[model samples]
Target: MDTRQRLRTSALVCAAAVGMLISGCSSGSSFSEASAPSGSSVASPPGAVSTEELKTYYAQRLSWRDCGVPGFQCATLRAPLDYAKPDGRSVDLAVARVKATGPGKRIGSLLVNPGGPGGSAVSYLQGYAGVGYPAPVRARYDMVAIDPRGVARSEPVECLDDKDMDSYTQTDQTPDDKPEVAKLSTAFKGFAAGCKSRSATVLPHVSTVDAARDMDILRGVLGDEKLSYVGASYGTFLGATYAELYPDRVGRLVLDGAMDPSLPARQVNRDQTAGFETAFKSFADDCVQRALCPLGTTSPEDAATRLKDFFAKTDAQPIPTGESRPLTESLATTGVIAAMYDAGAWPQLREALTQAMAGDGSGLLALSDSYYEREPDGTYTNLMYANAAVNCLDAPPAFTTPNEVDAAVADFEKASPVFGRGFAWASLNCAYWPAPATGSPHRIEAKGAAPILVVGTTRDPATPYKWAQSLADQLSSGTLLTYEGDGHTAYGRGSDCVDTAINTYLLEGTPPRANKRCT
Candidate 1:
């Protein structure tokens, strides 16, 4: 993640107020009876305990109880809140799995993680991956997910309440004065303090590396000899870390919408800003040909200029939606960002922009809601909270202060006039984090791991294509699967080419030829 969805993808800003509908994750048909033996389930380590206290954790019996879905059973996974103190406190992680329905022999477990450092892997599996995965793949393997610590339902981290978040999200990110900057800084500090207060232990332990360790524990507990996994966006970082930490134990790992752990937080955020610009150009290229385009039927550059001007206008005079909340500059920019996540959202963006230009902000508010994941009940998910928690712990802040962001403004503006300013400011979200970053920008060369597949979309807004190439090049046995297209991720986004290659790898243990391009 950029270090916010520059750490998780933008939560739905406006529309999530109704109910956020993210694409992918189909609700599959009813699941069949469990085929795997329960006795084989992992249990606490027996005999003399070694120095590795984690071994004891890896051996615990995970009691599975049927959740809402037919074959999907929920279980609690316990891991040390602080890996450095493994003999100390434990955190109960939420895990869910839908056993494979097979005509072929069961092929162990396939763990799936959606992009958010904070995105609920359990929800991703139950909603999409469990039933939405390839039929052959589903038939041969069990689909599983776990909510990493500090994320949803896994000792979730809490920050601002609904009304406070409403105000926070509306706070002027593109501050024009010292007062605005102070207000933004205060909000950042306040959010960090809230996480520290509510999730003191969990907050410090939710880094990507920590999450990877949790995955290894989950892998052992699931009775899998080797870990087979699929992770997207920030999830890719988690998967890559796992492969690096436990190379020999890696079965088949797929990293879609890959993040380059090699880059600093600023570079990642800056690169993502550019990537979103790339996506915007793609959107503008398409929009200019459409009459509904609010930016008018003009060149991409021209379209971007007009859109920037629109943000300027909204910034000056917030657009009033039918609701009490009016669309502010930050919300408007986020609304624009939500649409850039997937090409399918372009039309909605165009409509939203048109409505905003028409002085009705409801459409744009909905788009912003999509970015924030604010539900109709006005309750927010732990997404943004955990996103910042994990992101801040993974790396240092992009800008140490508002002044630093100001100093870098020109560089960012040079990066993307439309998004640079907003992203530069967004990068500072972790600046006031209570805990210092535990990890730094580095390479994860999973030397002895089985072939790990890295999927890169040509114009991914969040995780850019270059990141996949970089990660593929860094990994000892990495294979790059290029989706020569637009959007955040390639898998199951109407791409038989991308899906087939990934499916073959998962089922047959065949990696796509290195640097293979799929259209």
Candidate 2:
């Protein structure tokens, strides 16, 4: 499994915490809003295509209709399949919005993305941001979301079918020998091949850069002179890419759980491994304090040792989960990692671990299923498929061969003794990608951009706090907002200070003071 896929929004994590097991909250849709007129030309940065060539695309109007959900309208926006070939084929992007409900003067649209590179931004809007955002913020700005190209509702990438995906997920990630390594490699290759065979046309175009460009077009279609946005996890990378591509068009952008674009693929995986370890320690600390702690009422280090022992036990003999599929080490590890994304889920994780340790693997298996967006019927959302597509296209593979991974094992192990080996091996999935990487690790400094807020959780598991610091330092107008707490992203996660600062920025165009720390 790709570790980067863990960079999903806290909304999903909170869903798991609240026992909305199968999938998150459902969204209602209805149509009653008029379409926003296409605005004047939005200039592209130097070296981009001339605005004249893209006039047709920028000027096209969106026809909004009820999206089967109350209070939400959906529309499709057409963008070039390949930007270089503007006159060639096109890809349709799904866009959704809830018009501002205001007692105050309406601000412009506030586009929200919940990471995943694959997460359904539209679903996020209707299910969370559109209704759950602070009433004051929602009362002013129209909440908008566009599922980036090759994401949900758009042309999503398809990989292995359900049965094959089950086998793939159960594959041993930490190889004990040559045969195990070969088996893992074959699974990776098969996943890539399946994507190639099923989604050949759109796989290569799902890079973050392409998604960023799509955001610009969406901005124009919505008649926003400058984009106001909230992007989490990988969405932060997407938002940063947008600021870099069109600095002057950026407005009131908040990149919570920010990622550093400068890190290579290997570094990203390794850092995420360390990040998981950090979060695990936090969980372990809390777990030991509970009288019913499954790992024993011992120190955090002892809990880690016990957890590793459990993994080894599962590796040797898979635990039956009541379902046809058994709980293997990979699934259990994924389950644990999923819980690390939000502290609210720690209780669920503790219970899952308790059950797994007691020979009942149902809880852990369910958590793993949730992480993969697996439906109770065995179908899966296209989240993982698009996740791999975007991640692989955004950066070169972390390792070209098994030997490289073997060589880096020590570093990975040092970074995360429990998860490092699996994360190190997971990075190899992109090595078998059919398309070459279209992007590389580089610094992004949107020099002429308006103030951008970068939020970080001190114990964030997916995107490390250090990454937010790095991203804040990198962006020319970036300001850092630190949440001295746990969870993936900070805003809308119960931190009054964090929400107030971000809300102030969005409403009044005033960013939080640099290095402001909130609890």
RMSD of each: 6.5, 5.3
Tell me each candidate's TM-score: 0.90, 0.93
Q: Supply every candidate's count of residue pairs whose N, Cα or C atoms clash at under 3 angstroms.
A: 28, 5
In candidate 2 the C-alpha lDDT for residue 102 amounts to 92
* Deviation from native of the Cα of residue 184 in model 2, angstroms: 0.5
User: Model 2 Cα displacement at 147 (Å)?
Assistant: 0.5
Q: Which ten contiguous residues of candidate 2 have the minimum total lDDT?
A: 16-25
Model 2 residue 490 CA deviation (Å) reads 0.2
**Number of the top candidate by TM-score?**
2
Model 1: residue 46 alpha-carbon error in angstroms: 26
Superposed model 2: Cα runs more than 4 Å off: 1-9, 13-48
Off by over 4 Å in 1: 1-51
Q: Judged by lDDT against the true structure, how good is candidate 1?
A: 0.78
